[model samples]
Target: MSIKYKFHDPGAIYFVSFAVVGWIDVFTRSVYSDILLESLTYCRKEKGLNLHAWVIMSNHVHLIVSSREGYLLSDIMRDLKKYSSFRIVKEIRESTIESRKEWMLYLFAKAGQQNSNNKNFQFWRQDNHPIELDPHLNMFEERIDYLHNNPVKAGWVTNASDYLYSSAIDYEGGKGLIEIDLLV
Candidate 1:
């Protein structure tokens, strides 16, 4: 098998995006999204994930991240995805409020069966599509803008900063849900 995106530079920041299998809109519910947030928080605090910006859409997540001095961004991302997938799938299995619980679980199981890497469920697609950002070339502004404005483009909010599931608010000089290492 061939991989499209690779984490070549260990110290460089990357803009990475990953989606749910079949592009399912699993994050439409706050419970599922909250699980993702919790996982990200854990990574940031314990796994040396240096987050610059992030956004969680209905089916996917985009993050601008790097690793701390002794950590690898790729390793951090792998753990984040693994833990979040297990946690979210468990939530779906036990949730009393999820309207699409059966359907979502069935799809996840089917996807898992097809992928040899997973034994039961596959909540997230494998590729992060990590694109390293060049600090000297002013590439961050463009990626950050694109990441922040995703909710606006999706018609979820009129203003990007008004969206709660993103770092847009933090960039606007307001506090966001998770801590971010603001890009300069």
Candidate 2:
């Protein structure tokens, strides 16, 4: 892993992205995505995650985030991924309506078996690919725009703010599913 992608400055905000293993479209169902949303909410309330903006796509998530004082961004991200992975994998395993349950579980189990770090399954890819943002460099707006417009770019919605799984609504002066620490 390159040091460039690592979280070096705890106070500096960062743009991060993590995808499901194999880029599987697991989040096509709201039930699964809701698990992620709940986890993000929990992290925000309890883990000191300063979430500025975010989006949940079909198989991945993007965020502009940092840690509050006395918290480490890396630690928060690790716990987020670890908890979400376990919950999402368990949900898929136990879901009676998940048509692709067996296939998804098989893939996760295969990925886990191939990787020495996992014991049973690997739901999320290991790398967060974090990019630290310098607050003084006028990067927040650009990143937020890019993050919010992801669904629009994908043709899922005409306007970014219309996407239900993103913080674009908050940016548009509407409350979203989760709270956001707005960045100017």
The lDDT for every candidate, in the order shown, is 0.91, 0.90
Candidate 2, 67-181: lDDT as tens digits: 9999988889889988999999989888999999999999999999988877899988886679888777878988999999999999999999999999999988899998889
In candidate 1, the residue pairs with backbone N, CA or C atoms under 3 Å apart (3 or more residues apart, or in different chains) clash, namely none
How do the residues 1-184 of candidate 1 rate in per-residue lDDT, one tens digit apiece?
A: 2244588899999999999998999988988888899998999999999999999999999999999989988789889988999999999999898889999999999998988877899988876579999978888999999999999999999999999899999998999998999996
Candidate 1 residues lying further than 4 Å off, grouped into runs, are 1-5
- For model 2, the superposed segments whose C-alpha errors exceed 4 Å read 1-5
Q: What TM-score does model 2 achieve against the real structure?
A: 0.96
lDDT score, candidate 1, position 118:
78
In candidate 2, list every pair of residues with a backbone clash: none
RMSD of 1: 1.3
